[model samples]
Target: MKLKTEVEPRIDADERGYGGVCRNNLARSRGETHFYGRCGPSRRFFACSAIMLLATGLAFAARPSRPSPLPNFVLVVADGLRPDELGTRAVPTPALDQLAAQGIRFTQAYAGAPVDAASRAAIMTGQHTGHGRVRSELQVPLAPEDVTLAEVLRSVGYRSAAVGIWGLGWEGTTGLPTAQGFNEFLGCLDLVHGRDDQPAFLWRNEVPFVLKGNPGPAAAASAFEWMLRGATNFIRINEDHPFFLYFAPHLPGSSSELGAVRIPTASPFTNQTWTPSQRIRATRIAYLDEQVGKLVADLRKRNLDSETLVIVTSTASSDAANEMTEASKPRATPLSESNLRVPLIAWWPGKIAGGRTNNRPVAAWDIVPTLAQLANAPLPKQLDGRSFSALLLSQPPPTNSTRFYWEGHAGGLSQAGRIGQWKGVRALGKPSVAVYDLEVDPTESHDLAPTRRDLVAQFEALFAENSRTWSPPADGAVGAAGRPGYPIPTNVITQPLRTNSPPDGPATP
Candidate 1:
């Protein structure tokens, strides 16, 4: 599984006209693509080439005419949502269905990892589990050097806000949403506190805002409703300028008691003949749908419908034992396809064509680059994601050269990789591998690894190429209950302030 390297030929910067500025790394300077290490015969030829190269560079870097304003982005991340339950009889989701009817829906979308924190870290940092900072579900804050999607948007004159579960960091830590790049943040700051549907207090930026009469019948409202209100308020305040809102709601999650649903009530499904868990699941789905509908209606009311792009997707797979009702099929675990696949929908009015279903295999890591491309921002150097903005406009996207990689770090190290139609999975501490052809057998009910030796060798090399060594911190990080233990030295200096000023820098056309 060793890799081979080749040395590239060197050339003079002046000869290549490397002084000309290029907007992004995807575009190269004039005469740099084909003139890597070559030389012309005479001085006359070199003079002619420099003039041509300078003219070509200016043309390539020219701005577009009749440029449009920057579009707004709304990302909705849900927990414990299954892809198969969208159009089923168990739950009615008119709002989500309407959203799918207005934009493109991805059929073969997969999560970055099997757990919550790992999967979210991949999405925020534009790196998969192999190279991301937070690989497992541990309560680790994002290191100071880790850049997020919101930070990328902020660089392009776009204000950013977040509500609901913020799992990457908590209060007084570098992983806090405000410390990362969010202008305003409100909701649960840790995974342990996120489970309670009605907590006594939730973090507003860095301080606690107590919920009146929570954990009792006299409670004013559920945490879910409060998050929804906060999201809408942010949108209204920033309607005059470009913005990015991250709304992550914990819905239809597993309860503290085994085999039950985590919800406040079951009013919508009270008269049904289903089990108590089924009733609670249905009610939770209904509430989530209503909130989505309200968000869309608010955008239309403010005349911002055509200027915003709303993306609705799940964070990870549902818990089969507790979250899944009688409608869903048997779920899988430990890097199985069922555990990684989830729903992905994008809605943009008068921008993207509607009623189209895409089958391109996209993972959670692709989110950061996609938003950066849409905002016309510069991408970082160490990213593993390829942007799919062309796919949204009904055009072929940039071809991805690397295979998709995922790993689970809960019990022990497990690995999985996918290339074209072939998919491979290796269990924890097992020597054997299971391969499946996703084109013919999407369910992966049958195994073909016993007969495909060539594929096995390919996977072995792919796994070796994608993996990187990770070392966990000893102590002085955030504890399990969202308490700050001690401060670790890093490069970032963050100020958690509340202001309405727009992001610095003029908007790029």
Candidate 2:
């Protein structure tokens, strides 16, 4: 095949411009002839340059553009916080309410377990309590082989800082946040330490950062204030790059003192006529809301609001659930919705549509994969959670399993699952399963297992498919000691946080 163009060679110039002509550079060698067109004068030069520029622009546009920077993630877990405790009737959380209004709220979201360690483990490892290393509230460290969400993000160039309760592992153990892939860690290391609202010292990575005049009602500073500063510092330092900040505040939760909830100051609630317990709880919640508002404000001030995803959820604890008023309690059982259902709010300005609420069920385990997806990172192996990133973008969500499972080992093996609209609870050694139609009875007050054999069978089948018989490591297997680097003379710094009033007295002046 041959293609040919005929050119009538001529030189000419128009009145508006200089010469308009085309010159051919012809070369012949080895029985081959090549012709190149060269432009002449101002008119031809402009035309030729315009064509070349257009071609270059098209070529540049055709190449794949560089991907947008990965998004930042901030997961804030409030210790012992219950949803009902945040309404106008009790405590008002303006900051949290606004965050929910500007983000996607999950109405039927649940924690991975009824207690801290297991639920936190599930969140970190993307495995439910049935599969994760820390399956119960027992003090245990995650196995070294276990992969954490922080580690997953780190693989894709994220710098992680866990500021607050690193419940999964303690000091000198493989479960430490630093060991688990966090670039920085500051706060309480163990559950015992976490319970101390006025702890004399906190852990900064593997070292003891002493709080010289802390844990006192009249102390010049609060431990929480220090931790919040650490969190904001991390954000300021990593503003230019992708990062994950896990801020878990131990507030409105039980303190080491029996029947006591401690906060530095209960001023706003000090004048309220509520009971001491109620006032303390309200103050703590208010305090938390204020701190959260500040943190988010900091992000906005730094111009990181649009690129960051802030998730606010509560860690479900049976003990914490009981801390609420008797009337507010869901049911006598620990697996009840009141105990398991925690607030799940996701906020990403300019990414997720604001003021949207989704009824789709989300568990604690889903967080890992969701963040991984947002970062375009690879999914870690042996994960049980499916990413809900699509839901964030108002797109069709991932196909989540119809059945959700949870187990707790505090007294004995207790299991619970939700299949469609039916919720079932069964003790591992018991023969009978109590089922409730959650669609009708949101509180699980009416048991239908005795009447609905079909639902029971279905629940049994779901349990059979998902249940795993596993146990936590032996007590001595993992090191539970506090930071060993500190001197014995400073052991006084580890005392329980002090309180100004009795359990029944007013929380503040």
The most accurate candidate by TM-score is 2
- Against the reference, the lDDT scores of all candidates come to 0.70, 0.72
Alpha carbon lDDT of residue 395, candidate 1?
A: 80
Model 1, 1-509: lDDT tens digits are: 01111222221222222223332222222222111121223466558668988978744332222144888999888776767768666688899988998899999888888888877788888899889877777767876688888778877767777888888986666899977777677788887677677666666666565555565452344777667666776675466668899888876554322244334444576788876766766677777777788889878877788889998887777353335443455546658777788789999998889999998888888888898988898787778888878888778767764389987776678889998888988878887778889889976878898899898888888787888887556753444345443221132223221222222211111
Q: What are the per-residue Cα lDDT tens digits for candidate 2 across 158-228? A: 77889888788765677889788887787887865776776767776666645556545544456677677
Q: What local lDDT score does residue 162 receive in model 1, on the 0 to 100 scale?
A: 81
Listed in order, each prediction's TM-score against the native is 0.78, 0.79
Consecutive 10-residue window with the lowest summed lDDT within model 1: 500-509
Rate residue 320 of model 1 by lDDT: 37
